[model samples]
Target: MLRTQIIKLTRAPIRSFSAAAVRTAEGDTGGVRSGGVASSDSFNKREAASENKFIREREMETLRQLKEKLRAQRKHLDELDAHISDLESTKGGEQN
Candidate 1:
């Protein structure tokens, strides 16, 4: 088999260092050098913040549920106390 192939190469546009720096400072680096590299710290911070928010929301929900459970238990204890007091009063009258 005898075949010839033609390939074309394209050059990326060039930008001055000062211009690139300005873009980087403004946080608009388009994700690499030819465009702009995204800052790793900023990306990581964003991810951490999102994870923290999820954790906080879950914890808050759990706390709310626990508080509700505590309130119900307190109410039940108060009712039990009232019933015991009534029973004690009746027994005292019967004894007298």
Candidate 2:
């Protein structure tokens, strides 16, 4: 799962790079171009946007997993507390 996400995450940059390269080759700058290559500014902007989206998605996934773990732990802690209370009550009864 994580490996797949990482693969996808890493692929975005390459995909964007190749797309930009093709666009540059075709002279589709949509604006000014220098040295026969698309402006780095636009490319960088797109890359940064994609990266930010990926990071936000990844962080949300991590937070979801953490929340699930915390819920399970809380449930287990509640069960343990009940068991301890039962044991204490039984001990008190036996002494009476």
Candidate 3:
């Protein structure tokens, strides 16, 4: 009964593997036993959480770098526009 409950709590892939690997012994209530599968499950949860944190940090760093590059490109374009305006004014004055 305890094993059945645990199997239900686990995700499908882990459930399948754990159901096959878990060994049970009869308890006084016929529903309880002692083991460390729960500990193993906790470890897996922690590892997955750590991996997700790492992925999120990497994604945020990439986004920040892209934003900096975009800002630099905009600055360069603005400079070019100012230069073009100056050249156009000089040419108009010369033609007069």
Candidate 4:
């Protein structure tokens, strides 16, 4: 199917969290009545920290991939240059 081909072509991963779960957590904290603000603030801080960690990990992975690609491209370029030099040398010899 067309969808299958699209999935194969895409390499990026998708992540999602449900809003209902978040609302439920807030609702539970609200039901506690006492220390609700403190609890909410703590929960929010934890959530933010988790998101930040995930972002950093994804960034590191992307950077790692880019570094690997750069190394491969550099190696290919070096090989091409060497081939060109070889051809030039052969041509010079032919001229003489």
Question: Best candidate, TM-score-wise?
Answer: 4
* Residue lDDT tens for model 1, 1-96: 123222222445677767444335664535543423366666768988999999999999999999999999999999999999999999999999
Q: Clash totals for all models, in order?
A: 3, 0, 0, 0
13-42 in candidate 3: lDDT tens per residue?
533635466566663223323566686567
Pull out the clashing pairs in model 1.
Answer: 31-36, 32-36, 32-37
User: lDDT score of model 3?
Assistant: 0.82
Please report the candidate that would top lDDT against the real structure. 4
TM-score per candidate, chains pooled: 0.60, 0.58, 0.58, 0.63
Please list the residue runs of candidate 2 whose C-alpha ends up more than 4 Å from where it truly belongs after superposition: 1-38
C-alpha lDDT values of all predictions: 0.78, 0.83, 0.82, 0.86
Query: How much does candidate 4 score in TM-score?
Result: 0.63
- Model 2's TM-score against the true structure: 0.58
How are the candidates ranked when ordered by lDDT, highest leading? 4, 2, 3, 1
Worst 10 residues of 4 by lDDT: 25-34
TM-score of 3: 0.58
Error of 1 at 5 (Å): 45
